[model samples]
Target: MKNFEIIANLLKEIWPEHHAKLTSEICQLSSDDAFLLDYIAEKIILIKKDKLKQAIKNYKQTCAVIVQEEIHFRRTQSYRLKTEQQADTEIYSNSSFMDMYLDGLLISQLFWSNHFKVFQFFCSSFLTQISKDDTLNRFVEIGPGHGLFLSEIVKKLPSRECLGYDISESSLRHTSQALQSLECAANVQLINKDIYNLPTDQNFDAIILSEVLEHLEAPQEILTKLSHHLTPKGLLFINVPVCSPAPDHIYLFKTPNEVQDMITSCGFRVNETRYFPMTGYSLERAIKSQATISVAAICQLST
Candidate 1:
Protein backbone atom coordinates (compact mmCIF):
# COMPACT_ATOMS: atom_id res chain seq x y z
CA MET A 1 0.00 0.00 0.00
CA LYS A 2 2.96 2.31 0.51
CA ASN A 3 3.81 1.99 -3.15
CA PHE A 4 0.26 2.87 -4.10
CA GLU A 5 0.51 5.97 -1.98
CA ILE A 6 3.81 6.81 -3.63
CA ILE A 7 2.26 6.50 -7.07
CA ALA A 8 -0.76 8.51 -5.98
CA ASN A 9 1.48 11.26 -4.69
CA LEU A 10 3.41 11.28 -7.97
CA LEU A 11 0.20 11.45 -10.00
CA LYS A 12 -1.06 14.23 -7.79
CA GLU A 13 2.14 16.14 -8.42
CA ILE A 14 1.80 15.62 -12.18
CA TRP A 15 -1.94 16.34 -12.43
CA PRO A 16 -3.02 18.33 -9.43
CA GLU A 17 -6.56 18.89 -10.70
CA HIS A 18 -7.43 15.17 -10.60
CA HIS A 19 -5.68 14.41 -7.34
CA ALA A 20 -8.81 13.63 -5.34
CA LYS A 21 -10.36 11.41 -7.99
CA LEU A 22 -7.11 9.56 -8.65
CA THR A 23 -6.54 8.91 -4.96
CA SER A 24 -10.14 7.71 -4.58
CA GLU A 25 -9.85 5.33 -7.52
CA ILE A 26 -6.60 3.92 -6.17
CA CYS A 27 -8.39 3.20 -2.94
CA GLN A 28 -10.99 1.07 -4.69
CA LEU A 29 -8.57 -1.67 -5.60
CA SER A 30 -8.27 -4.69 -3.29
CA SER A 31 -5.07 -4.85 -1.26
CA ASP A 32 -3.52 -7.56 -3.41
CA ASP A 33 -4.38 -5.84 -6.69
CA ALA A 34 -3.09 -2.63 -5.22
CA PHE A 35 0.22 -4.29 -4.42
CA LEU A 36 0.56 -5.72 -7.92
CA LEU A 37 -0.17 -2.34 -9.47
CA ASP A 38 2.28 -0.75 -7.07
CA TYR A 39 4.91 -3.24 -8.15
CA ILE A 40 4.56 -2.06 -11.74
CA ALA A 41 4.56 1.57 -10.68
CA GLU A 42 7.61 1.02 -8.52
CA LYS A 43 9.47 -0.65 -11.38
CA ILE A 44 8.67 2.20 -13.73
CA ILE A 45 9.65 4.76 -11.15
CA LEU A 46 12.80 3.06 -9.90
CA ILE A 47 14.59 1.41 -12.81
CA LYS A 48 14.62 4.25 -15.34
CA LYS A 49 12.52 7.29 -14.63
CA ASP A 50 14.16 9.29 -17.39
CA LYS A 51 13.56 6.57 -19.98
CA LEU A 52 9.93 6.24 -18.86
CA LYS A 53 9.52 10.01 -19.13
CA GLN A 54 10.99 9.92 -22.62
CA ALA A 55 8.61 7.12 -23.53
CA ILE A 56 5.64 9.19 -22.35
CA LYS A 57 6.90 12.14 -24.40
CA ASN A 58 7.20 9.93 -27.49
CA TYR A 59 3.68 8.60 -26.93
CA LYS A 60 2.26 12.09 -27.45
CA GLN A 61 4.14 12.34 -30.73
CA THR A 62 2.86 8.92 -31.75
CA CYS A 63 -0.69 10.09 -31.09
CA ALA A 64 -0.32 12.62 -33.87
CA VAL A 65 0.47 9.79 -36.28
CA ILE A 66 -2.53 7.87 -34.98
CA VAL A 67 -4.77 10.89 -35.54
CA GLN A 68 -3.73 11.20 -39.18
CA GLU A 69 -4.19 7.48 -39.75
CA GLU A 70 -7.61 7.54 -38.09
CA ILE A 71 -8.67 10.24 -40.51
CA HIS A 72 -7.56 8.04 -43.37
CA PHE A 73 -9.42 5.08 -41.82
CA ARG A 74 -12.61 7.12 -41.49
CA ARG A 75 -12.49 8.00 -45.15
CA THR A 76 -11.49 4.55 -46.43
CA GLN A 77 -13.32 2.43 -43.84
CA SER A 78 -10.33 0.10 -43.60
CA TYR A 79 -6.97 -0.33 -41.87
CA ARG A 80 -3.83 0.87 -43.53
CA LEU A 81 -1.97 -2.42 -43.39
CA LYS A 82 -2.99 -5.36 -45.54
CA THR A 83 -0.71 -7.95 -43.87
CA GLU A 84 0.93 -8.81 -40.56
CA GLN A 85 4.29 -8.88 -42.30
CA GLN A 86 4.01 -5.14 -42.78
CA ALA A 87 3.55 -4.63 -39.04
CA ASP A 88 6.54 -6.86 -38.31
CA THR A 89 8.73 -4.97 -40.71
CA GLU A 90 7.58 -1.53 -39.67
CA ILE A 91 6.98 -1.83 -35.93
CA TYR A 92 7.92 -5.06 -34.20
CA SER A 93 11.31 -5.42 -35.84
CA ASN A 94 12.36 -1.94 -34.74
CA SER A 95 13.88 -2.73 -31.36
CA SER A 96 14.36 0.83 -30.18
CA PHE A 97 10.82 1.79 -31.09
CA MET A 98 9.33 -1.23 -29.34
CA ASP A 99 11.39 -0.60 -26.22
CA MET A 100 9.98 2.86 -25.98
CA TYR A 101 6.45 1.68 -26.78
CA LEU A 102 6.57 -1.10 -24.20
CA ASP A 103 7.97 1.27 -21.59
CA GLY A 104 5.13 3.63 -22.34
CA LEU A 105 2.65 0.81 -21.87
CA LEU A 106 4.05 0.03 -18.40
CA ILE A 107 3.76 3.66 -17.36
CA SER A 108 0.31 3.95 -18.86
CA GLN A 109 -1.01 0.91 -17.06
CA LEU A 110 -0.03 2.56 -13.80
CA PHE A 111 -0.91 6.23 -14.31
CA TRP A 112 -3.25 6.46 -17.26
CA SER A 113 -6.73 6.39 -15.74
CA ASN A 114 -8.44 4.49 -18.53
CA HIS A 115 -5.66 1.95 -18.86
CA PHE A 116 -5.66 1.47 -15.11
CA LYS A 117 -9.38 0.71 -15.24
CA VAL A 118 -8.86 -1.91 -17.94
CA PHE A 119 -6.06 -3.52 -15.92
CA GLN A 120 -8.29 -3.56 -12.84
CA PHE A 121 -10.98 -5.28 -14.88
CA PHE A 122 -8.49 -7.89 -16.03
CA CYS A 123 -7.28 -8.68 -12.47
CA SER A 124 -10.79 -8.79 -11.03
CA SER A 125 -12.07 -11.00 -13.83
CA PHE A 126 -9.18 -13.42 -13.47
CA LEU A 127 -9.79 -13.59 -9.72
CA THR A 128 -13.46 -14.39 -10.34
CA GLN A 129 -12.48 -17.21 -12.72
CA ILE A 130 -10.04 -18.70 -10.19
CA SER A 131 -12.74 -18.65 -7.53
CA LYS A 132 -14.99 -20.74 -9.77
CA ASP A 133 -12.27 -23.11 -10.94
CA ASP A 134 -9.29 -23.16 -8.61
CA THR A 135 -7.68 -26.00 -10.50
CA LEU A 136 -6.32 -23.77 -13.29
CA ASN A 137 -2.68 -24.84 -13.20
CA ARG A 138 -1.26 -24.68 -16.71
CA PHE A 139 -1.26 -21.18 -18.24
CA VAL A 140 -0.07 -19.63 -21.48
CA GLU A 141 0.07 -15.93 -22.32
CA ILE A 142 0.51 -14.65 -25.87
CA GLY A 143 2.14 -11.24 -26.30
CA PRO A 144 2.99 -10.60 -22.70
CA GLY A 145 4.48 -7.22 -23.45
CA HIS A 146 4.63 -5.50 -20.05
CA GLY A 147 4.42 -8.69 -18.02
CA LEU A 148 2.48 -7.03 -15.21
CA PHE A 149 -0.52 -9.28 -15.78
CA LEU A 150 1.64 -12.37 -15.98
CA SER A 151 3.44 -11.44 -12.77
CA GLU A 152 0.08 -10.93 -11.08
CA ILE A 153 -0.97 -14.41 -12.20
CA VAL A 154 2.21 -15.94 -10.87
CA LYS A 155 1.81 -14.14 -7.57
CA LYS A 156 -1.84 -15.07 -7.13
CA LEU A 157 -1.58 -18.61 -8.44
CA PRO A 158 1.77 -19.68 -7.08
CA SER A 159 1.07 -23.27 -7.94
CA ARG A 160 0.53 -22.63 -11.66
CA GLU A 161 3.08 -23.02 -14.42
CA CYS A 162 3.12 -20.24 -17.06
CA LEU A 163 4.51 -20.07 -20.56
CA GLY A 164 4.64 -16.81 -22.49
CA TYR A 165 5.22 -16.55 -26.24
CA ASP A 166 6.02 -13.27 -27.93
CA ILE A 167 7.43 -12.36 -31.32
CA SER A 168 9.51 -9.55 -29.87
CA GLU A 169 12.67 -10.52 -28.04
CA SER A 170 12.42 -7.27 -26.16
CA SER A 171 9.03 -8.34 -24.82
CA LEU A 172 10.36 -11.71 -23.78
CA ARG A 173 13.25 -10.11 -21.96
CA HIS A 174 11.01 -7.66 -20.18
CA THR A 175 8.63 -10.40 -19.14
CA SER A 176 11.45 -12.52 -17.84
CA GLN A 177 12.98 -9.68 -15.85
CA ALA A 178 9.62 -8.61 -14.45
CA LEU A 179 8.79 -12.06 -13.23
CA GLN A 180 12.29 -12.49 -11.81
CA SER A 181 11.98 -9.26 -9.89
CA LEU A 182 8.77 -10.53 -8.31
CA GLU A 183 10.70 -13.50 -6.85
CA CYS A 184 7.68 -15.76 -6.95
CA ALA A 185 8.06 -19.54 -6.88
CA ALA A 186 5.70 -20.06 -9.84
CA ASN A 187 7.28 -21.79 -12.81
CA VAL A 188 7.62 -19.44 -15.81
CA GLN A 189 9.07 -19.74 -19.28
CA LEU A 190 9.35 -16.81 -21.65
CA ILE A 191 10.03 -17.66 -25.28
CA ASN A 192 10.62 -15.49 -28.31
CA LYS A 193 8.43 -17.17 -30.89
CA ASP A 194 5.24 -16.49 -32.75
CA ILE A 195 2.19 -18.00 -31.09
CA TYR A 196 1.19 -19.73 -34.33
CA ASN A 197 4.52 -21.53 -34.38
CA LEU A 198 4.00 -23.13 -30.99
CA PRO A 199 3.19 -26.85 -30.85
CA THR A 200 -0.50 -27.65 -31.30
CA ASP A 201 -0.59 -30.71 -29.07
CA GLN A 202 -0.06 -28.80 -25.85
CA ASN A 203 -3.26 -27.76 -24.13
CA PHE A 204 -3.38 -25.22 -21.30
CA ASP A 205 -5.81 -24.71 -18.45
CA ALA A 206 -5.82 -20.92 -18.95
CA ILE A 207 -4.82 -18.79 -21.94
CA ILE A 208 -4.36 -15.03 -22.10
CA LEU A 209 -4.20 -12.95 -25.27
CA SER A 210 -4.64 -9.42 -24.01
CA GLU A 211 -4.27 -6.37 -26.28
CA VAL A 212 -2.88 -8.53 -29.04
CA LEU A 213 -5.70 -9.23 -31.52
CA GLU A 214 -5.62 -5.75 -33.04
CA HIS A 215 -1.95 -6.17 -33.90
CA LEU A 216 -2.58 -9.14 -36.18
CA GLU A 217 -3.98 -9.33 -39.69
CA ALA A 218 -6.09 -12.40 -38.90
CA PRO A 219 -6.87 -12.42 -35.19
CA GLN A 220 -9.52 -15.09 -35.63
CA GLU A 221 -6.88 -17.50 -36.86
CA ILE A 222 -4.99 -17.11 -33.60
CA LEU A 223 -8.20 -17.35 -31.58
CA THR A 224 -9.25 -20.53 -33.34
CA LYS A 225 -5.81 -22.01 -32.83
CA LEU A 226 -5.89 -21.12 -29.15
CA SER A 227 -9.34 -22.63 -28.81
CA HIS A 228 -7.92 -25.92 -30.05
CA HIS A 229 -5.05 -25.67 -27.55
CA LEU A 230 -7.34 -25.08 -24.57
CA THR A 231 -8.25 -27.93 -22.24
CA PRO A 232 -11.89 -29.03 -22.16
CA LYS A 233 -12.89 -26.50 -19.51
CA GLY A 234 -10.04 -24.03 -19.92
CA LEU A 235 -10.65 -20.30 -19.74
CA LEU A 236 -9.47 -17.73 -22.26
CA PHE A 237 -8.97 -14.06 -21.44
CA ILE A 238 -8.87 -11.48 -24.22
CA ASN A 239 -8.71 -7.71 -24.34
CA VAL A 240 -8.85 -5.38 -27.33
CA PRO A 241 -9.17 -1.71 -28.02
CA VAL A 242 -11.95 -0.36 -30.26
CA CYS A 243 -11.38 2.74 -32.40
CA SER A 244 -7.91 2.84 -30.88
CA PRO A 245 -5.32 3.85 -33.41
CA ALA A 246 -1.69 3.24 -32.58
CA PRO A 247 1.43 2.94 -34.72
CA ASP A 248 1.32 -0.87 -34.63
CA HIS A 249 -2.44 -1.37 -34.47
CA ILE A 250 -3.48 -2.83 -37.82
CA TYR A 251 -6.91 -4.40 -37.39
CA LEU A 252 -9.71 -2.29 -36.03
CA PHE A 253 -12.79 -3.26 -34.02
CA LYS A 254 -15.50 -0.67 -34.48
CA THR A 255 -17.61 -1.83 -31.54
CA PRO A 256 -17.47 -4.06 -28.47
CA ASN A 257 -20.06 -6.34 -30.06
CA GLU A 258 -17.70 -6.94 -32.97
CA VAL A 259 -15.05 -8.30 -30.57
CA GLN A 260 -17.54 -10.64 -28.88
CA ASP A 261 -18.83 -11.89 -32.20
CA MET A 262 -15.29 -12.57 -33.38
CA ILE A 263 -14.63 -14.70 -30.31
CA THR A 264 -17.91 -16.59 -30.66
CA SER A 265 -17.14 -17.30 -34.31
CA CYS A 266 -13.81 -18.81 -33.22
CA GLY A 267 -15.75 -21.47 -31.23
CA PHE A 268 -15.48 -19.78 -27.83
CA ARG A 269 -18.54 -18.92 -25.76
CA VAL A 270 -18.30 -15.53 -24.13
CA ASN A 271 -19.04 -15.61 -20.40
CA GLU A 272 -18.50 -11.94 -19.56
CA THR A 273 -17.60 -8.67 -21.23
CA ARG A 274 -16.26 -5.43 -19.69
CA TYR A 275 -15.65 -2.09 -21.37
CA PHE A 276 -13.73 1.01 -20.34
CA PRO A 277 -13.59 4.27 -22.24
CA MET A 278 -10.82 6.84 -22.39
CA THR A 279 -10.49 8.97 -19.31
CA GLY A 280 -13.01 11.81 -19.01
CA TYR A 281 -15.30 10.30 -21.66
CA SER A 282 -18.49 8.27 -21.47
CA LEU A 283 -18.81 5.10 -23.53
CA GLU A 284 -21.28 6.81 -25.89
CA ARG A 285 -18.97 9.78 -26.23
CA ALA A 286 -15.99 7.57 -26.94
CA ILE A 287 -17.97 5.65 -29.58
CA LYS A 288 -19.41 8.76 -31.21
CA SER A 289 -16.07 10.50 -31.47
CA GLN A 290 -14.20 7.38 -32.54
CA ALA A 291 -12.09 7.54 -29.41
CA THR A 292 -10.48 4.62 -27.67
CA ILE A 293 -12.49 2.13 -25.60
CA SER A 294 -10.89 -0.99 -24.05
CA VAL A 295 -12.93 -4.22 -24.19
CA ALA A 296 -12.12 -7.33 -22.15
CA ALA A 297 -13.85 -10.71 -22.27
CA ILE A 298 -13.71 -14.13 -20.59
CA CYS A 299 -14.59 -17.14 -22.69
CA GLN A 300 -14.45 -20.91 -22.95
CA LEU A 301 -14.97 -23.57 -25.63
CA SER A 302 -18.56 -23.53 -26.83
CA THR A 303 -20.56 -26.47 -25.53
Candidate 2:
Protein backbone atom coordinates (compact mmCIF):
# COMPACT_ATOMS: atom_id res chain seq x y z
CA MET A 1 0.00 0.00 0.00
CA LYS A 2 1.17 3.57 -0.64
CA ASN A 3 2.09 5.67 2.41
CA PHE A 4 -0.83 8.02 1.79
CA GLU A 5 -3.24 5.07 1.71
CA ILE A 6 -1.76 3.73 4.94
CA ILE A 7 -2.20 7.07 6.68
CA ALA A 8 -5.76 7.31 5.44
CA ASN A 9 -6.52 3.83 6.72
CA LEU A 10 -5.07 4.59 10.17
CA LEU A 11 -7.21 7.68 10.47
CA LYS A 12 -10.31 5.63 9.64
CA GLU A 13 -9.63 2.98 12.28
CA ILE A 14 -8.75 4.90 15.46
CA TRP A 15 -8.61 8.61 16.21
CA PRO A 16 -5.04 9.73 15.56
CA GLU A 17 -3.37 10.00 18.94
CA HIS A 18 -3.09 13.83 19.08
CA HIS A 19 0.67 13.77 19.74
CA ALA A 20 2.23 16.44 17.53
CA LYS A 21 5.56 14.65 17.11
CA LEU A 22 3.99 11.36 16.13
CA THR A 23 1.64 13.03 13.69
CA SER A 24 4.43 14.97 12.01
CA GLU A 25 6.61 11.86 11.60
CA ILE A 26 3.60 9.96 10.25
CA CYS A 27 2.88 12.74 7.76
CA GLN A 28 6.51 12.87 6.64
CA LEU A 29 6.18 9.24 5.57
CA SER A 30 3.39 10.50 3.21
CA SER A 31 3.25 8.08 0.24
CA ASP A 32 5.69 5.57 1.72
CA ASP A 33 3.36 3.15 3.58
CA ALA A 34 5.88 0.31 3.22
CA PHE A 35 8.69 2.45 4.57
CA LEU A 36 6.48 3.58 7.45
CA LEU A 37 5.69 -0.06 8.28
CA ASP A 38 9.36 -0.99 8.08
CA TYR A 39 10.24 2.02 10.23
CA ILE A 40 7.69 1.05 12.88
CA ALA A 41 8.56 -2.66 12.72
CA GLU A 42 12.24 -1.94 13.25
CA LYS A 43 11.41 0.27 16.22
CA ILE A 44 8.86 -2.18 17.60
CA ILE A 45 10.21 -5.10 19.60
CA LEU A 46 8.93 -7.28 22.50
CA ILE A 47 5.49 -5.58 22.31
CA LYS A 48 2.95 -8.18 21.12
CA LYS A 49 -0.60 -8.47 19.74
CA ASP A 50 -2.22 -10.00 22.83
CA LYS A 51 -0.65 -7.25 24.91
CA LEU A 52 -1.95 -4.51 22.64
CA LYS A 53 -5.41 -6.03 22.86
CA GLN A 54 -5.05 -6.18 26.61
CA ALA A 55 -3.83 -2.58 26.73
CA ILE A 56 -6.79 -1.26 24.77
CA LYS A 57 -9.11 -3.31 26.95
CA ASN A 58 -7.45 -1.95 30.06
CA TYR A 59 -7.62 1.65 28.82
CA LYS A 60 -11.30 1.50 27.82
CA GLN A 61 -12.22 -0.22 31.06
CA THR A 62 -10.26 1.39 33.87
CA CYS A 63 -7.13 3.49 34.54
CA ALA A 64 -4.33 2.50 32.15
CA VAL A 65 -1.13 4.46 31.45
CA ILE A 66 0.16 5.08 27.90
CA VAL A 67 3.92 5.58 28.13
CA GLN A 68 5.70 7.40 25.28
CA GLU A 69 8.68 9.64 24.70
CA GLU A 70 8.35 13.39 25.32
CA ILE A 71 10.24 14.09 22.09
CA HIS A 72 10.62 17.81 21.37
CA PHE A 73 13.34 19.34 19.21
CA ARG A 74 12.68 22.78 20.66
CA ARG A 75 9.37 24.28 19.37
CA THR A 76 9.12 21.85 16.43
CA GLN A 77 8.06 18.23 16.98
CA SER A 78 10.36 15.29 16.15
CA TYR A 79 9.85 11.57 16.64
CA ARG A 80 12.63 9.58 18.29
CA LEU A 81 11.39 7.55 21.27
CA LYS A 82 7.70 6.63 21.56
CA THR A 83 5.61 3.53 22.18
CA GLU A 84 2.00 2.97 23.33
CA GLN A 85 1.83 0.53 26.20
CA GLN A 86 -0.94 -0.56 28.49
CA ALA A 87 -0.03 0.35 32.09
CA ASP A 88 -0.32 -3.23 33.31
CA THR A 89 -0.96 -5.11 30.10
CA GLU A 90 0.76 -4.78 26.69
CA ILE A 91 2.05 -2.22 24.18
CA TYR A 92 1.41 -1.45 20.49
CA SER A 93 0.89 1.35 17.97
CA ASN A 94 -1.52 2.03 15.07
CA SER A 95 0.40 -0.17 12.57
CA SER A 96 0.72 -3.05 15.04
CA PHE A 97 -3.02 -3.24 15.69
CA MET A 98 -3.93 -3.27 11.98
CA ASP A 99 -1.37 -5.97 11.23
CA MET A 100 -3.46 -8.19 13.53
CA TYR A 101 -6.87 -6.48 13.47
CA LEU A 102 -8.42 -6.13 16.99
CA ASP A 103 -11.97 -7.34 16.28
CA GLY A 104 -11.68 -10.63 18.21
CA LEU A 105 -10.55 -9.13 21.53
CA LEU A 106 -12.90 -9.73 24.47
CA ILE A 107 -14.13 -6.77 26.47
CA SER A 108 -14.45 -8.57 29.82
CA GLN A 109 -11.52 -6.93 31.60
CA LEU A 110 -13.44 -3.73 32.31
CA PHE A 111 -13.92 -4.95 35.89
CA TRP A 112 -10.24 -5.70 36.49
CA SER A 113 -8.97 -4.34 39.82
CA ASN A 114 -5.46 -5.16 40.97
CA HIS A 115 -5.12 -2.17 43.34
CA PHE A 116 -7.74 -2.88 45.98
CA LYS A 117 -6.29 -0.72 48.77
CA VAL A 118 -6.44 2.43 46.69
CA PHE A 119 -9.93 1.55 45.61
CA GLN A 120 -10.83 0.68 49.21
CA PHE A 121 -9.53 3.94 50.62
CA PHE A 122 -11.18 5.78 47.74
CA CYS A 123 -14.56 4.22 48.55
CA SER A 124 -14.62 4.40 52.33
CA SER A 125 -13.22 7.90 52.59
CA PHE A 126 -15.59 9.32 50.00
CA LEU A 127 -18.70 8.02 51.70
CA THR A 128 -17.46 8.92 55.16
CA GLN A 129 -16.71 12.46 54.04
CA ILE A 130 -20.18 12.98 52.65
CA SER A 131 -22.06 11.61 55.60
CA LYS A 132 -21.72 14.26 58.31
CA ASP A 133 -24.31 12.46 60.39
CA ASP A 134 -23.74 9.12 62.04
CA THR A 135 -26.04 7.71 59.39
CA LEU A 136 -25.39 8.02 55.64
CA ASN A 137 -28.62 7.76 53.74
CA ARG A 138 -29.31 8.28 50.03
CA PHE A 139 -25.83 8.09 48.52
CA VAL A 140 -24.87 7.98 44.82
CA GLU A 141 -21.55 6.64 43.52
CA ILE A 142 -20.57 7.53 39.95
CA GLY A 143 -18.52 5.07 37.89
CA PRO A 144 -18.81 2.25 40.39
CA GLY A 145 -16.42 -0.18 38.69
CA HIS A 146 -16.47 -3.80 39.87
CA GLY A 147 -18.79 -2.68 42.71
CA LEU A 148 -16.08 -3.60 45.19
CA PHE A 149 -16.49 -0.32 47.03
CA LEU A 150 -20.24 -0.65 46.91
CA SER A 151 -19.91 -3.90 48.85
CA GLU A 152 -17.80 -2.05 51.39
CA ILE A 153 -20.48 0.56 51.84
CA VAL A 154 -23.17 -2.10 52.33
CA LYS A 155 -21.10 -3.60 55.10
CA LYS A 156 -20.58 -0.26 56.88
CA LEU A 157 -24.01 1.32 56.52
CA PRO A 158 -26.40 -1.54 55.80
CA SER A 159 -29.53 0.56 56.18
CA ARG A 160 -28.57 3.35 53.81
CA GLU A 161 -29.70 3.27 50.18
CA CYS A 162 -26.68 3.27 47.88
CA LEU A 163 -26.94 3.92 44.15
CA GLY A 164 -24.15 3.36 41.60
CA TYR A 165 -24.08 5.24 38.30
CA ASP A 166 -22.02 4.46 35.19
CA ILE A 167 -22.31 5.10 31.47
CA SER A 168 -20.78 1.75 30.54
CA GLU A 169 -23.38 -0.97 30.27
CA SER A 170 -20.68 -3.58 30.74
CA SER A 171 -19.50 -1.87 33.91
CA LEU A 172 -23.06 -1.78 35.22
CA ARG A 173 -23.36 -5.49 34.51
CA HIS A 174 -20.20 -6.13 36.47
CA THR A 175 -21.47 -4.00 39.32
CA SER A 176 -24.73 -5.96 39.40
CA GLN A 177 -23.01 -9.33 39.26
CA ALA A 178 -20.42 -8.48 41.88
CA LEU A 179 -22.95 -6.98 44.26
CA GLN A 180 -25.32 -9.92 43.73
CA SER A 181 -22.56 -12.37 44.58
CA LEU A 182 -22.06 -10.55 47.88
CA GLU A 183 -25.84 -10.60 48.58
CA CYS A 184 -25.71 -6.80 48.92
CA ALA A 185 -27.48 -6.18 45.63
CA ALA A 186 -30.55 -5.19 47.60
CA ASN A 187 -28.79 -2.18 49.10
CA VAL A 188 -27.59 -0.80 45.76
CA GLN A 189 -29.15 0.42 42.52
CA LEU A 190 -27.00 0.64 39.37
CA ILE A 191 -27.99 3.05 36.62
CA ASN A 192 -26.55 3.45 33.09
CA LYS A 193 -26.94 7.05 31.92
CA ASP A 194 -25.13 10.23 30.94
CA ILE A 195 -24.33 11.98 34.23
CA TYR A 196 -23.94 15.38 32.60
CA ASN A 197 -27.66 15.63 31.81
CA LEU A 198 -29.17 13.33 34.39
CA PRO A 199 -32.77 14.47 34.72
CA THR A 200 -33.54 13.67 38.28
CA ASP A 201 -35.54 15.54 40.87
CA GLN A 202 -33.83 13.26 43.35
CA ASN A 203 -30.96 14.73 45.32
CA PHE A 204 -28.37 12.61 47.00
CA ASP A 205 -27.50 13.16 50.64
CA ALA A 206 -23.97 12.08 49.78
CA ILE A 207 -22.22 11.97 46.37
CA ILE A 208 -19.12 10.02 45.40
CA LEU A 209 -16.81 11.13 42.53
CA SER A 210 -13.85 8.83 43.06
CA GLU A 211 -11.05 9.31 40.53
CA VAL A 212 -13.67 10.14 37.91
CA LEU A 213 -13.17 13.86 37.29
CA GLU A 214 -9.94 13.46 35.30
CA HIS A 215 -11.55 11.41 32.50
CA LEU A 216 -14.10 14.10 31.78
CA GLU A 217 -13.97 16.91 29.15
CA ALA A 218 -14.78 19.85 31.41
CA PRO A 219 -14.50 18.49 34.93
CA GLN A 220 -15.29 21.89 36.36
CA GLU A 221 -18.59 22.04 34.50
CA ILE A 222 -19.54 18.59 35.73
CA LEU A 223 -18.66 19.48 39.32
CA THR A 224 -20.40 22.79 39.01
CA LYS A 225 -23.59 21.07 37.88
CA LEU A 226 -23.21 18.38 40.53
CA SER A 227 -23.21 21.12 43.16
CA HIS A 228 -26.99 21.29 42.84
CA HIS A 229 -27.62 17.53 42.86
CA LEU A 230 -26.20 17.41 46.33
CA THR A 231 -28.69 18.15 49.05
CA PRO A 232 -28.13 21.28 51.15
CA LYS A 233 -25.44 20.57 53.73
CA GLY A 234 -24.79 17.40 51.75
CA LEU A 235 -21.24 16.15 51.61
CA LEU A 236 -19.37 15.51 48.33
CA PHE A 237 -16.67 12.88 48.53
CA ILE A 238 -14.16 13.04 45.65
CA ASN A 239 -11.01 11.15 44.67
CA VAL A 240 -8.73 12.47 41.87
CA PRO A 241 -5.49 11.40 40.24
CA VAL A 242 -3.12 14.07 41.59
CA CYS A 243 -0.31 13.13 39.16
CA SER A 244 -1.11 9.85 37.45
CA PRO A 245 -0.10 9.61 33.78
CA ALA A 246 -2.93 7.85 31.97
CA PRO A 247 -4.04 8.38 28.36
CA ASP A 248 -7.61 9.09 29.48
CA HIS A 249 -6.62 11.39 32.32
CA ILE A 250 -6.85 14.84 30.70
CA TYR A 251 -6.77 16.91 33.88
CA LEU A 252 -3.46 16.33 35.64
CA PHE A 253 -4.08 17.76 39.08
CA LYS A 254 -0.41 18.37 39.92
CA THR A 255 -1.22 18.81 43.60
CA PRO A 256 -3.96 18.21 46.14
CA ASN A 257 -4.31 22.01 46.49
CA GLU A 258 -5.31 22.34 42.79
CA VAL A 259 -8.08 19.82 43.27
CA GLN A 260 -9.21 21.64 46.41
CA ASP A 261 -9.30 24.93 44.52
CA MET A 262 -11.48 23.43 41.78
CA ILE A 263 -13.89 22.01 44.34
CA THR A 264 -13.88 25.24 46.32
CA SER A 265 -14.57 27.17 43.14
CA CYS A 266 -17.63 24.99 42.72
CA GLY A 267 -18.82 26.51 46.02
CA PHE A 268 -17.98 23.60 48.31
CA ARG A 269 -16.25 23.81 51.67
CA VAL A 270 -13.23 21.56 51.95
CA ASN A 271 -13.12 19.59 55.16
CA GLU A 272 -10.23 17.14 54.77
CA THR A 273 -7.88 15.90 52.03
CA ARG A 274 -5.09 13.32 51.76
CA TYR A 275 -2.71 12.32 48.97
CA PHE A 276 -2.02 8.71 47.83
CA PRO A 277 1.01 8.89 45.57
CA MET A 278 1.91 6.38 42.78
CA THR A 279 4.80 6.46 40.30
CA GLY A 280 5.84 4.34 37.29
CA TYR A 281 9.13 3.72 35.44
CA SER A 282 10.14 3.91 31.75
CA LEU A 283 10.20 0.09 31.47
CA GLU A 284 13.88 0.78 31.96
CA ARG A 285 13.60 1.94 35.59
CA ALA A 286 14.09 -0.83 38.13
CA ILE A 287 11.27 0.60 40.19
CA LYS A 288 8.88 3.55 39.96
CA SER A 289 7.32 5.04 43.06
CA GLN A 290 3.57 5.33 42.96
CA ALA A 291 2.20 8.87 42.71
CA THR A 292 0.13 10.14 45.61
CA ILE A 293 -3.58 9.43 45.02
CA SER A 294 -5.25 12.44 46.68
CA VAL A 295 -8.57 11.77 48.40
CA ALA A 296 -10.64 14.67 49.64
CA ALA A 297 -14.20 15.47 50.74
CA ILE A 298 -16.07 18.74 50.45
CA CYS A 299 -19.47 19.80 51.71
CA GLN A 300 -22.20 21.74 49.91
CA LEU A 301 -23.07 24.12 52.70
CA SER A 302 -26.52 25.49 53.31
CA THR A 303 -26.43 29.26 53.58
What is the Cα root-mean-square deviation between model 1 and the actual structure?
3.7
Q: Model 1 over residues 158-277: C-alpha lDDT tens digits?
A: 777888899988777767766666664247888889888879788899998889999998899999999899988899888898887677888989988899999999999988888888
User: What total of clashing residue pairs does each candidate reach?
Assistant: 0, 14
Query: On a 0 to 100 scale, what is the lDDT of residue 84 in model 1?
Result: 80
Q: What is the lDDT of every predicted structure here?
A: 0.77, 0.53
lDDT per residue for candidate 2 within 45-105, as digits (tens), equals: 1122334334333333332212332212122232222221231123222334322222111
lDDT of 2: 0.53
Worst 10 residues of 2 by lDDT: 104-113
Clashing pairs in 1: none
Model 1: residues with Cα > 4 Å off, grouped in runs: 1-40, 46-78
